[model samples]
Target chain A: MRSFLSSRWGKLAIGVVLVGFAAMLPLLNIHIPGVLPGPTYTPGALSVLAYAMLIAALALSYHLIFGVAGMLSFGHAMFFAAGAYGLGILLNLLAPSGMPPEAVFLVAIVLTLVVALVLGNLVGALALRVTGISFAMVTLAFAQAANVMIRRNTGDLTGGEEGVRLEASLVPEALVGVVNTRNLYWLALGILVLVYLACVWIERSRLGHVVAAARENELRVTVLGLRPYTVRLFVFGAAAVLAAVAGIGFMLLQSSATPRISTADFTLTLLVIVVLGGVGYRWGAIVGGIVYTILDQRLAELASSSWIAELPPVLHIPLSEPLFILGMLFVLVVMFAPGGIVGISHRLTKGRGGKKDAAEPAVLQDLEA
Target chain B: MSTVLLLLITGVGLGALYFLVASGLSLIYGLMGVLNFAHGSFLTLSGFLGWEVGRRVGDGTWLGLVVGMLVGLVAGALVAAITELVFIRRLYNRHIEQVLVTVGLGLASVALFEGIWGSDPIQISVPGWLRETTEILGSHIPNDRWLLIGAAVVVLALIVLFLQRTSYGLVIRAGVENRTMVTALGIDVRRAFTIVFAIGGAAAGLGGVLASVYFGTVSAHQGTSLLIYAFIVTVIGGLGSLSGAAIASVLVAVIQQFANYYWGIGDLAIVLALAVVVLVRPTGLMGKVKH
Candidate 1:
């Protein structure tokens, strides 16, 4: 624990205070004084915050594998879906309604973790066998096939194209009760904070350094007389479990898990979040998640109904198709801001270029087009 | 005996579609050295355009079929050029970015396809003569299936011939082996790469049109699905190896048919086979050992 908070004590302290504020957000308000009538702390905002926090937590777990371990996986949705459906099935089949919600959640989480262990180890073992582009493509095939399998034939187990509704008894009442909004917010924010700190510790640990080195050059690690695969596989398995836990938070917040859970688009969403913030950086995932969710949600509203919809075609660019805008954003970020928002700021803080950051792969400048 | 013959034809016919799509994918990967995640987008888009042209001229006419296919081929080639010039050409070595940008392009294109065509799978028809069935052994088989088989054989041969006989083909083969050496030789390797990409697009367009007619409908999501099969074939065949892709596609198709016939597993068998292949041969079944 001391080592976990060893050097980042001040930052950790501030983060805890901020979480406290978030937990008490319903009682707090932000006033613009002249134009605004009240604090924007509405019930809707709580749900959005909870959702964003869960997503950000999930994104952080992805950062552990992709950013830290340099393993690009397209099958993360598999883990997410498994965690969600695992909980739903446990509640529906094994647990009685008379069981305590807390006990049910604990059992469900344990079950989900077991599933994650088996899956994470299996996938890590398989995925670690390939490197670079083939790695991404192979994982993609696995996930896509899984998506097809679960959606059409396994309706009895998965609810098929229509997802199974999570039982009310599965989630702790404090997390889902009508009047327990504050408690839900506290739990979500708390989990987000814990997951964030845990990821930060992972990044700072010796294993984290080893994973980073392996990510940069597996051959180098081999030359150094260390096995890169074993180190990366360990990270992969742990990160998969964390991601599964985040999925449980997502299910608890939404009160249901749909077949949409397994879609590649969801994994893409996580990818966009990680890239939008910055890969490998500690805090980028959370920032990226909040920014992405708000942008996605608001852009849709502005395009369809808000006064922003009445704007000229020029301004309505992203607001038009929205997905076109998101796609374009991804391209532009990758092209110009390869380090994303965090890396850009980090670079600006230093001198120009700053030795190109070892974590960054071959730059787009090689294109020379 | 008839059942066996039917399965064989079925497997071969399926393999031909996989060949048409995967061959282009292999060529693109071979010559360009970039994974075109949007290859299926071209397939889907071209198939839809072809179907539209065919529908206007009435079903199953030679003129309509030719016009439709031509439309698909031209559009596919154009898209490939634009895709290369606008995006891919600029991001050569940064593969993760390549995956993201191409995936984004593919997704946005799928949305555009859905917007234009709606979610409905558009019905397409083959020419009357092509639709007729002939008895082979004891089972009746569609004449178009034979046409598909013949087309596959011809395409494969033409590809080999072009590579072996044409100066452009030699340049491509050399470029695949060593891009730098080929460029140093004053071959304008990038231009060669562009042509190869356009050819890939054209081939995928051909596959798209054939798939539309063969499957009798074209859906927006088929691009991603077909792309997966193409990826599977290309990967298993050894990326950029024409012969490898050809052999692997047929093997995968036979496996798919067997699994579906016996266990009703359909595509799952392909995924499982791929998993097994990756475990045993990480580079793929026919993939050249990389240094």
Candidate 2:
């Protein structure tokens, strides 16, 4: 069974089953008391799931840069924001241009993609010049600059502190109102699948091999006459574009693009998601994103619950802050479970006499190197 | 001309604050290779606690302010040292994990602070004289600017002295140059790591109180906002270089002031300057370390 599961057809069969199950989730009447706010068929549950899928998509993109390519970036949120705010502002701008709604929507998305592509290339080109912590700092500085611009509402385009809302008139009927939430959920699911497949393709491609090898030993890659810089830049750009795609989904689902999306904190959250899912595993990003979103939402509810408020101040204060809990969880994961959820699961399987894979925790390997 | 003077002095004053935070960050990164994300949390916590103590002692008085500054300094050092000992020590030799730990601490601590202090910026009373402006060469410079500048200069001098004159400083210098060589010399370098964290925390703590004076209030987020600029300064000055941090702090702050006044693009200008410096000379202006 294990050998068959490791085979290509078995993996494909599992993938089909999982995707089909996820697609049928909204039609199911399942109710998870602590996890989902309502039954799966309800708009609330669907919206929450949609948001999770969108975040999962974003995390997958981040996984490409940090997990796959071993580039730790603190500015990834800027690309996501570009896609969200870009599509938002463009829709608002082009709404009154006398074009059909479909044409306007298509043009806005294309423009957003172009903007994200340009931004990705520009930032990647400049930031890739340096390596390690300096690279992280450079990305951070640029992101901060972008955040400042978004907050300052340069040219009054970003709507500043209030953020930009999607022009309902410009959006297609299938993705606009609360009644169309299931459609949006389907859209989000589609995006997650698309992003996941893209990540898989990228990871399988020759470029992915070169990038991974460079992460392990840049000197060795250099010796082989490969410029690690160009390949790294390419992966970075690809990740940025993918992040933008997730951002577009986010804007559509939420119907608004806020300055909050552009923050360094948001990028940090993505980093946490990537690490939590198990840094080097693509599936880890997806799992981490889903788990984090649900936990974040549930924790907020738990914080405001009557039982929590009745507790002592010490317990009350810590529990009331979801981020605080998540942050501590992230720290614990880094310290105790370096491979994150995937690592722990792998260990459990190995202990159960499952097929032993030779892969160690990538983060641990990074440390040993 | 008077305006230029005001901007220059004020810019220098702000730079002094950056140096306070960046100095510790530079040393810690230089010697330990940890970026110390929690450095800002140290500042924030110290600022809150120092303000808490100072108000109980006496608010709106010079003595109160002085006492607060000292409290902030001690608080910063204590928390930083504890962080290095407890969280950082366990992750020893694992640079990425150490950074992740700090990042987690930074996020968690900020949230906890918001819970305890409330998210709003709390106004703190300063001495009456500190609220007044002093005339300097026909320009009315805020008196607090002088205090900030004075405190930062003393900090820079003291740190320089410590690094050059102390045995621990010698170990740190050697460690920054090459940790393996330092370890090979049979020196217990872990103690030096704790010392660097402590020193960095102290400066950030002092900067915290002064930052309150500069901004007229302390918010849960003040440290984080300031830390970003400090990071830019640390990078432009070249990480691990005290002198580099000092020079870059002033240069970045002055440019920020000038750009903000002239074109309302202070933050963008600083980022641009950082980019130019990084691209042109990745080692930074005064960076001697290869990293």
Which candidate ranks first by lDDT, i.e. highest?
Answer: 2
Candidate 1, residue A221: how far the Cα is off, in Å = 0.9
State fnat for each of the candidate structures. Answer: 0.42, 0.75
The residue pairs that clash in candidate 2, if any, are none
TM-score per prediction, in order, is: 0.90, 0.99
- Per-residue error at A265 for model 1, in Å? 2.8
Task: List clashing residue pairs in candidate 1.
Answer: none
Report the lDDT tens digits of candidate 1 across residue range A1-369. Answer: 434533468567767787777777778786443222235366566676777788888889888888777777888888877777777777786566566777777877898889987888888788778876677667777787778777864647777777767788556556666466556666778778878878878878888888888776667789999898888888888887888888877777777788787887788778888887887776778888877876776666656766766788556544456666776787788777877778777777456433345344332222211
Question: Which number leads on DockQ?
Answer: 2
lDDT of 1 by residue, B1-291 (tens): 887777778788889989988888888777665778788888998999888887797667888887888888888888887887788777865556776778778866776676567778876677887777788898877777776677789889988999899999999988877777888878788777778878788878878888887888899877777788878887788887888889998889888888889888878889888888888887776676242
The segments of candidate 2 whose C-alpha lies over 4 angstroms from its true place after superposition are: A363-369
Error of 1 at B4 (Å): 3.1
Interface RMSD, prediction 2: 2.2
lDDT of each: 0.77, 0.92
Worst 10 residues of 2 chain A by lDDT: A360-369
